[model samples]
Target: MTDTATPLISLTWTDHITGRRGHLVVDRLVRGVASGGLRMREGCTLDEVAGLARGMTMKEALHYTPGARYIPLGGAKGGIDCDPRAPEAYGVLVRYLQAMRPYIAHFWTTGEDLGLTQGLVDKAAAEAGLTSSIQAVYPLLDDEEAARRRLADAFAVEVDGIGLGELAGGCGVAEAVLAALDRARRPYQDTRVALQGLGTMGGATARFLTRAGLRVVAVADAKGTVANADGLDVEALLAARDAFGTVDRAALRADDVELPGDAWLSTDAEVLVPAAISYCIDSVNQERITARWVVEAANMPVRPEAEALLTARGITVLPDVVVNSGTNAWWWWTLFGDIGADADEALGHIRRSMRTLIDLMLARAEADGTTPRAAAHALVADRLPEIAARYGWYR
Candidate 1:
């Protein structure tokens, strides 16, 4: 069995100029290729980076198909333990990229996550004299287009006349939640959902679910939680929210009710989506979560023991590996599959892949009489030996 206890490579570096620290965790290497995101947030640590790296590895393994016929890129993650609001943050990022230059070129390709922006990422790559390693993944692109994209990436311009990529976690989670409801023979229109963390992923998820005919009764962000029994106006909420996804308290309608902190946990809802951060549902709060379906749109959003407790209480927890996989699906398709210049087509491909994968996991879990997480890990275990042999990582 593949050892999950240790990462293949874990490196820590300090920016002597600013006294900032950075970490890069490579969970595994397949054909010497690894890829993940670079996240910058206050209080970030090496251990969190390593855990996220491992999640990426599991995500790739769970989605792998033998017929794809390519060396699966292993998982890696990078983190900067600095307040993004600080003036020295940009300098710290540049220096961190410089320190990681060798690995970034030879083994790892990092992208934006959390507090990192595309412009900052491109600036760092330029400062480090590195080309777009992501281009290496798209071998099927026409020579002219490939050259054009490389130029665009080098100049930090739009590629194929499109802007930077977006987080599709919400799109994937919405599809997965639908798949889960369908499996349980529940009606989407009749379902009420309480969402925590109204940032990029959470905001998008709430919008999609509301559009899909689900009632988003409660929505929460770093600021606070707002609820309406008859369902909140998602479009209006989106209009009132800031770039960070915090809803304005004054924007609420007369009928809207402001709930206490953590009140979303006790809200009357059939589905709960935690899209904010890790361990949102822990030992103390797990007991109060009213949703029967907990769809995780954030990595490791549910603690292990909390997940167990919820399961015992008859709550079905859909894991992040399956529910929040839209971004990964988008990357895989852009690299290997034929995604043209259309954004809708690209998103459609991701939604379809997520639905298929969620269905497969649900079926497997049902057949094995186990949780979805366990079923996913079991599939990963079964595929590890084959993947290792295919890549010649082991005999």
Candidate 2:
């Protein structure tokens, strides 16, 4: 494995509000605000948090935000190791809020990530006395309900010209998929996809693909996977999915086969999507993958080793920066316009961005004999220092 010093970044957060004092490992603070998501899971680690922050750094540079110039408001991320479903989560979250209060008031802004809910975010924001004015980097919705309303308003009425499946992250991915398909000169309709994790990102991506005329043969959630080689019943799946992507397996019919949790990886589809967790398809499970194309809908779903293995096998792997353009797009809109109008508009922008980035990256990879991951990194690395230089931050 290519080794480098722990990426230069600052990280300091309260382990437990009542326990240890919080710490900070900031590489460089651009302005008063450093934005990132908070991951609450049992397995979260410091290194992972730093990596995500690095990604934010790259993202901010690529987009050239105001801090992108004068200061480096690269992205920052924080995680608390706890299970969301556990009763302890609320207490832990409160402690987290209490510990992070000082930073949240100044140079750091935290948002919902894995295991974090809107209710939790609202509660924390309330206790912190957070308001719209505090949001110097991204525009903050007055409240969580407003954020949801914005999303609903944007998607409340579906456009007639767009297919139902062509509407979500799947649609965004579909754009990328189409680009990849075109580059290989392969026919689009014959392509099939099996999706792991059917949450907002996964569900949207699946639906969009279906609408784009690609067949979704398998889909899975935390509960279990449901497969139908002929094609999954997207309508039925959506009808049965709960607020948090849970499906009532009791209602599932006998015709559908239930497979172990990671069954989505073994499916015989042209494309595979690991849209669940970060590093879900790590080195251990990388060998079992059967798809020729792997698209990342979730952030950092594949580790370096797994990604390298896939690349060596002649598989097309799309990096999260380009493939998971959905969230970044939303964040941009949230930071700029009124959150309400920007939610849906953000999705449209994400699709276009992913399509364009992927198309460009693939062409570059093929022409240069470099892997997709390397190509994406090179692209980010090239632009980041430029942003730093332009802003006169590097000197």
Candidate 3:
């Protein structure tokens, strides 16, 4: 009954700075040198941390973590159960890092995660005196003007991070869908999409997908879903949206159906993106799923039961870890600078990696009479063992 795929390691930190306690869950250690972002959410729990760690496992398997795959490189995640918006959050963050210094010397590395910022990352690392030889000077780099020129020359596309509300998961979904479409020979020129979450990540992803020529057909938040088959005006929606990604239900009425909270899945569209939270799709609502392809923009949106049903029915479902594998990869890649010269180029590289991995997984799945999830697992299983043997983990 237990999922053996999940990794297990715990790093606990006590912050004297803000008088708080933080725990870093290194879900799974890939190649004994795994890394992930540090998230600070008020209600983060051990179960959530475990789920995230497992997500990282899938990510490292499908998308190459910084270390060589055959080198036992696995996935891990960390969560700080504290309100990041609180006034004394920074002090608490520094103290948390200091407390966590003991285990950090090992192969595990931590970066920024949801509800955290690069400023916090720099502050914590600086206070801990934990400097990486890779990017010896990890600059926060918030100066947009200076970065533009630097990024432009480094990579073809524009590079902007801190300025953008990092919709890492959504971005990964977009890349996955594009890759799926590419393999199906489906043109992304005017594909309609339904966005189920309008949070920071969801919003950012919607913008990117829209700009890339995908007509967003419907968008929904915690409140409800708004639909316009002729393609909902994403820009206007953003303008009208509040901070929580919720649009005023009273303001826009366009043949919208206000079903129960989970009605977003029923909306007709080529792709359905659930990036809001975990377990958005379960066995009960699994039958209502109509999207040709269900791309998980959120971590573990489709529960195991729901995923089994969907897979049995021949739906192409991309795993959350694979679909949302960008930010973590970017964080570690940043340390090496072995990816792209600039942010724009780096993102392009990341996107390409996501696309290729998806395409390869789907292809392998077809040939092996398996699901992409299984195919991805097989790929990781094969790769990790080889790496482990090389590093003498088993031998």
Candidate 4:
């Protein structure tokens, strides 16, 4: 196994105008290149950035397919401690990108993560005169229509009638949930799901799960939690939500019962999805969770102690590395120009890829008699030495 103690590089920057601090951490580099996402949150810190970068490394390694001979990219992450809603956000992003331009152009590439978007990444990249690191991974398509679709997918913008990339991440999680249910011979149509954090990822996941025939009984966001035993109207909630996925406090209906933010944990739903902030489910709250299965759409949403507790209680906790890999798969497809011209085809490919990955992870977990998190980490650890040796970095 490889050591996880140190990252390859870590850098910090300050925006003179906004007085904002930013950090870029590359946990590992393969062939001298790494990629991850840029996160902007008021509470984000360098340590969190480093942790996320390490997660990205493991994620990329799991995404590699031997059949395709795909060499996985290394893990790296960028974070800025600032409010994304502030008026100075754009300026801060510009300054941050300018400071990170060299790494962007030469060694590291990043995209949208929590509190950030692909549009912002594009804007800052353009300002820095740097091509997106995504462009480097895949071959350039000669067809103009395909190129347009590719850009639309990457930037989460509508182009030529194609919708945004909001569904990518959730769709992956939905597929993983379905796979897990199928493996257990559980009927998804009758399964009740409680979703915490109805933000972009959670909202999309709710929509996909509902469409796939699951009943989402409860939903929550930053504002509050709402539930209907019969099943919440996901479409109505989506319509009522703001662009940031916050439902107005005054928008609750007569039948909707509002609860404290953490009350979602007490719901008797068979499936629970945590898609909001990190460390949301910890030792203190783990005892309250009633879901038999927890799919992590948000990175590190479950603390180690919480996960261990849940596992001890016979709850199946699917790690974010596998459950929330749809966007990463989308990025892989986009980079290699593997996705077809049609949107449906692209989505189908993503879902299929998710299913395959989930199956592999589950099988590995069963064989090793370990949790999916350990299985995934072990898989990456097994491959790291070979990768490092190839790059002449192994001791």
TM-score of each: 0.89, 0.82, 0.76, 0.90
Give one clash count per candidate, in the order shown: 0, 17, 10, 1
Error of 3 at 136 (Å): 11
In candidate 1, which residue ranges exceed 4 Å CA deviation?
1-4, 69-71, 133-164
Every model: Cα RMSD to truth? 3.6, 5.0, 5.7, 3.1
Q: What is the lDDT of residue 93 in candidate 2?
A: 71
Q: What C-alpha lDDT does candidate 1 achieve relative to the native structure?
A: 0.78
Measured on C-alpha atoms, candidate 3 has an lDDT of: 0.66
The 10-residue segment with the lowest total lDDT in model 3: 132-141
lDDT of 3 by residue, 265-302 (tens): 88778888887766779999989978788888777788
Tens-place lDDT digits, model 2, residues 1-395: 11122434555565544343223333334443566667677767777777777666554544443431123354667777777777666676766766666666666666666667444676766665664212444333345555545544554445443322224445566677777877777776788899987766777777778877788888888877888787877766766777566667765666777887888988989989887788888887888888989988777889988888888888878877667654544454443442334335555666666667787678778787998777776776766656556543422
Maximum-TM-score candidate: 4
Q: Pairing residues by index, what is the TM-score of model 1?
A: 0.89
Residue lDDT tens for model 4, 106-129: 678688888776767787778877
Better of 2 and 4 by lDDT: 4
